[model samples]
Target: MPIEQGGRVSWGVDHLPYGVFSRPGQAPRVGVRYGDRVLDLAAALHDEVFAAPSLNPFMVRGRAAWQATRALLREKLTNDMAVTEAHLVPLEQVRLHLPFEVADYVDFYCSLDHASNIGRIFRPDAEPLLPNWRHLPVGYHGRSGTVVVSGTPITRPHGQLKAGVFGPCVKLDIEAELGFVVGTPSEMGAPAGAFEDHVFGVTLLNDWSARDIQAWEYVPLGPFLGKSFATSISPWITPLDALPRIPGPPQDPEPLDHLRRRADWGLDIVVEVAINGEVVSRPPYASMYWTPDQMLAHMTSNGASLRVGDLFASGTISGPRREERGSLIELTWNGNDPIKLADGQTRTFLEDGDTVTLRATAGSITLGEVSGTIR
Candidate 1:
């Protein structure tokens, strides 16, 4: 697509997000979003930089390559004679695929609001923040195999539940998250500052959850079948360099040097949750208590090596208000309160035919959206 008269697209030249795409009867290829158009990267770059079905190869090429690629695209879009129009395709005409392969997935419970509210529900008489909660980025390894692209329908998962119950999960829910993708692998014992060199981009993630199964199974260990069924991600990944960080929340009992981040790692993105066609919540990404960089530092503090395409997600991002809660469990107070939908439908938990969409916007550009229908 021509870089428009005003030299800005909805995604804009500043945000040349990348994704894999294909049209009817065509092989999947790499494409970069420029405004409302998708530029076939293979054709525009005049090479096979993005020939593979996934973006792993391109992503793992390191920061220099990523910067060079973005620079080239920005220059081309800025100059009128830099490229031809034939290489661009209307975004609505093509299918966007998973931008990169996921090697490992970790979900962190770092949101003070989300955790505090949940703590009250599970342990009303106890302190909201558990011991050691503020000192570390508490998280768990998730099933990477079940991660899927946007638009993929998720079947409600069945698992052992509370009160000896076992069946399709009745309390199916969604967690709005900002997922960080690793581009450069880090050696064991890399500090949190390695974030500047290793982390690649960001994607909107929907961590599908089964609250009933989780409540029952979480006695000894954390999430398993309740969360492993599926995790959906947006098709495009906005490179880290493209986003300007905003100030993050201050940590009490300051973190150690390994978890320290001098720069503001928080994002000032507007997050919203839509059910069917109506927006139910507006969760702010800036409200997150733990930054992705801190999570990375903690994940590797144990000498765990990082790999390309590894995904680390900010667990359910809930804010201080009732409407901003990311899941029905908190919004409905564990199903005790029913929320009204746009169509005048009332629901405590997701019912069959319910569609939940998680979306975010950074300034005027969309960070991309992920949605899944309960089938």
Candidate 2:
């Protein structure tokens, strides 16, 4: 049997979890992952056989429904239920939505490696990290209105691409990242919630990039069209409450007094990326220079209100290792050297028809996977 966290069962190999939207004739609006199948959450909820008083309150609301749904799944699997006559649905039948409507979106460049690689290329000999980097979580507000679920195709965007020698480019690229969704909202004046409550869940994120276009336009205010094109996320969201609460040590060199969080503020979720069905890059969530809680605290420090459904992506969590790099620009060193894949195709940046998938799993519990075909 799996262990429990905060009175809820910890997700494990025996139990798989998923999210769902209601439909007629569906067993219930819930999805359970047993091996390869995506069990319907809606079906489980309606069935009196799977009764749980704890999950009664969250049966309707989208976010709460998912949370309660997972909690019960863990219980059922751990206890080993005998109801084998489930409505068994195909994994493809699951209609994956945003999991929750996003109220806001924020992206942070918390990886010093990513910042340094780009900074060195742009401003050689300059300090790679900004002075405020260690003191706070640096971020840019994103377009929540544009976020989409996995399997969505993103068109190569058009924007300014300024290259001194080569003139400019219409090229595009992808950035691998771990996205955090806000579980609870903060009051107008009250301080941000502790690390435990601020972060609700984790998902794989693919932040598409138009490198050439970005280079030309990102002079004064950072990324614009180069980034705003389209961002994709995996369908299922793994609530933070479901994973093991094993806390990691504080980030290196210790954070500023105000930014420092409790010892267990961060999780060690693994993040990886694939291109054309090939695993090109893989890295642990621990590679992040900062934690999601710190980012939340910093965002709310100025009294900026945080609302539920807010999506905060820990900026390309790149590490010092070469294979751990997250973006094409960084991986290829700004196109100076292209990465050759086993598939006989070399990619300095993303190409037309290239499909990229971002997948993350902690132990046997997956946060699901997000994939997009570039056109």
Top TM-score hit: 1
Provide backbone clash counts, one per model: 0, 14
Candidate 1 residues 91-152, lDDT tens each?
88999888888999999998899999999988999998899889998999999999999999
Give Cα-based local distance difference scores for all models. Answer: 0.87, 0.69
Model 2 per-residue lDDT at 156 = 74
**What's each prediction's TM-score?**
0.95, 0.84
Candidate 1 off by > 4 Å: 1-9, 80-82, 189-193
Candidate 1 minimal-lDDT segment of 10 residues:
1-10
